[model samples]
Target: MMRVSLSGARGLMLISTLLLSTTAFAAPDATKIANSVVASLQAKGGTKASFDSAAANGDDVVITNLKISNEGSEATVPSVVIASPVERTPGGFTAKSIAFDAGKVVDGDQTISWKTGISNDAIVPDPSEMHSTAKITPFSHFEIAGISVVNKSAPDPVTVDSVTFDLGNVIDGAPNDGKLAISGINVPGSVLKSAGQGASTLTDLGYDSLLLNIGVDGGYDSAKNALTINGITVDGKDIGKLAIGGTFGGLPREKLQNADQLKELAPTATLEVASIRYDDAGLTNRLLDMQAKQLGAKREDLVAMVPGFLPLAFSQVNITDEAFKTQVSDAVSAFLKDPKSLSIKFAPTAPVLLMDVSKAAMVNPNGVISLLGVGVSANN
Candidate 1:
């Protein structure tokens, strides 16, 4: 697993390959380019003869029967591609604005692009373990926008406004040699609606924008050998905000391809929650609403029901301070009604395995939670 665990690559590769099949063809006229595209597909082992056709406006080709997905995930689409005639570049052809569904991507105007980078060409040994054969192929620049993907397995569609990744070409391809600049990964709260139904125990989260270098100016840093996912922030409009960062070290490619192996590896990770701020009243109200939604009860009814449920939960963790619990409960209750701000920060003194934190949370949550901080930031 590489830093950031770009897990969805396989799915993206499947659809992108349908578009890349045309990379081999280029022409001055759109019609000529269309002809080349049709011919290119025809030569491949098979492109459904009935499913392939091309039309032209001026310099771009309108293609069909590419048999790819209109949604980013599914394979069901009358994929209409408008490819610019492949103009020669210093290194490779330009993958210009490609339109499908309701989005257009001006991927990049740079050199040295490979079809394999956009397409996944790896074999999956275990369905449960999400891992790909470790490979690194950096693009000069890549961008996509307004892509609404309905992952059928998931409860809702994942809509991405845009995502751009720029892995700077380095003199050497060492693990720490190059820096990858990325941003514009905006996931709206609508994507969280269904998933949050289960998370209703927390707060009803809303639209939040995450920027890595997006926050800081022109952010890019040397690569790391560990799998690191940082710059995580969750915002709840009426509640508060949460930010987290983490890096999992000692992860080799082969080890990550298995589910059971993750627990063993968690011990080598350094993770942190920079801030968790909440308005007590707003949070309690939201949690009540969430509990109501999850239990299908009226919010008023949950007012009575939740308190009864809290004892068992607190007792399971052996929290028996009536005075302290009352203060905590009262704070939560007061916060729920009128809202009072509460902020928490965790910074571990040294690296600790994620496994230790998980175990510690069961006993001493505050002490264990602090153990998540790593020795360095993901962008360092």
Candidate 2:
């Protein structure tokens, strides 16, 4: 028995036959790869089209408690426990978030722990190796929290503590290439004034609680075709301290040059906040002397007059967490007495995809603006 060493037992039987040939090579149906990543993020529209229509018609968007843990030969990365029920229909939006935790990806790293909004720890990759590699790169931290969205002429109820997306390297390749990113984001002026239809600026600023700070660098290079939004910074204390500069130019070339006359042109991308401040309250020189009497113009013409007179722009704004700062300061004093009705609307020929705005600036004497800086260009 002391001499039983046949070449170390044939190298431990070839490392147990390559760990049973990578576990018998069959592990690719994480609910059909999470429904083809929720249908390629609903055909790549903005704000990922409200999370792809709340994961397609809301209600248990798959992920029924899957748990797989292995460490010895390294093979973990499957720990999802989700319970969803989010309805945003005709005017009857509903909400529900119970025990949502995610994290467990050892070899390729992907961590998660849930409570509703969503906890974080991510390095993500191996969506089963991105289904045999057409082009799969991953790095993530897409967090969410106790989020809520309701309609039917809202009065009270809109909460989201977090919405983090630091998708560093999300490339999925070829002609229709890829890229999605995020950098240092913090949203919580009670989820940006409880979103849409104005929650009354937290009852006229008697101050209960309000805090929304945000930061995000940009990138979306489908192989240098271009879509780079590299600016947007906002601070808050009841709708003050803002900075939204510029940098958005021609970006629509994931190979769909015509796709039937660009699907009947309805393209749009606008952003303008040109200036705002209140900590010291210089009021940017009384809003640049009221834009120099509406003609001697300055502040980049009030941020390029936001698409010729405001409709949508101020790309990505944030002030998360606020209960009811005097109903968001009397709805930002009636949205600055009609600041062009502060708008937000998206409809690239809708298909379970739309984002309308105005919960009185999305909630708490609030002012939560988030525009993924819309893009789609190529009209040489």
Candidate 3:
């Protein structure tokens, strides 16, 4: 009888240990995760956020009737889904993905709506860190599809195919690199013609709709205290493409948190290198032809007039040096005649300090051009 009793007691201890292990690995609370996200949003600024309900659906949490407001603007989502969420810290969570369906934002007489949006590898940090110097971001990458804007004053809606932002990684609350891509921005010709002044140039250039795509990519190096811009490009189908790239130095990680600190560091900041390049698909020639027609002249005649006009334009900007002005005039004349590719480059003998450049500009603006090592080339 004693041996049987001891065996039963051992079996009970084994059963209790198994139960404890299961409880330790239990799923995260869905409702708590939803509330923490609302808390984080509110902590960010003059924003209010809430959700009607949150419940677990398999491994995902579905938040219903999510709404956010800032100032007089309000946005509402029918539902949001956070998939496979895991707690990273107390009141912080990371998820495999988050999704939004059919959201609308209302601001005065204008409304913006989207069919769907999704973010991958999302991070929701503690509320206390939202306004801190940490600069925490919520997601690594996100995309929204079928975005439409409607206004009471406008005749028709403007639509976008997609808008996306990507941050490769977050370390110490800063992105290692970043990108923003906006594609298929369609604005009607009537809207452009009515938008006053030079906007009509777009329509006159035979653009029924200004279908534009914009992209920006950049990265930072903490070790070198530098920021590198891969490129910021604007491409219009059948029009032209413009790209700008540059590198800047003397930006330490800590100074990024405060505008005042950055301002103080600006004097010592350096422009290491910079470039602007434009490739004309057809728009450059078309624009020159249109302008020539308006002035009752041929395209070649218009091109010839630019070299004479440039000095007058440069003089307005305090550019008095004849040699510098001549260089610019010749480059512009060549580009206008060929309508091919034009590139402007700056590569100083050494990284140029902002303070020296500023003082030189005030003393002699024309000298500042040479001080920056400006170079322009056409059809190269």
The candidate maximizing lDDT is: 3
Q: How much is 3 displaced in model 2, in angstroms? A: 70
CA displacement after TM-score superposition, residue 9 of candidate 1 (Å): 54
Count of backbone collisions within predicted model 2: 58
Model 2 root-mean-square deviation: 21.7
Put down candidate 3 lDDT per residue, 306-364, tens digits, no spaces.
78887678878898877777777778888898888889998887898988899998888
Cα displacement (angstroms), candidate 2, residue 181, comes to: 12
- Model 1: residue 57 alpha-carbon error in angstroms: 7.4
Q: What's the TM-score of each model vs. the native?
A: 0.44, 0.26, 0.90
Count of clashing residue pairs in every prediction: 6, 58, 0
Global fold similarity of model 1 (TM-score): 0.44
Residue 242 in candidate 2, Cα distance off native in Å: 2.2
| Candidate 1 global lDDT | 0.43
Q: lDDT of candidate 2?
A: 0.36
Worst 10 residues of 1 by lDDT: 110-119
Candidate 1 lDDT by residue in tens digits, 248-363: 45565444545657566665554422434443324555566667888999987766555457668767877565654564565444444444554444566655556777788777
Ranking by lDDT: 3, 1, 2
Q: lDDT (CA) for every model shown?
A: 0.43, 0.36, 0.86
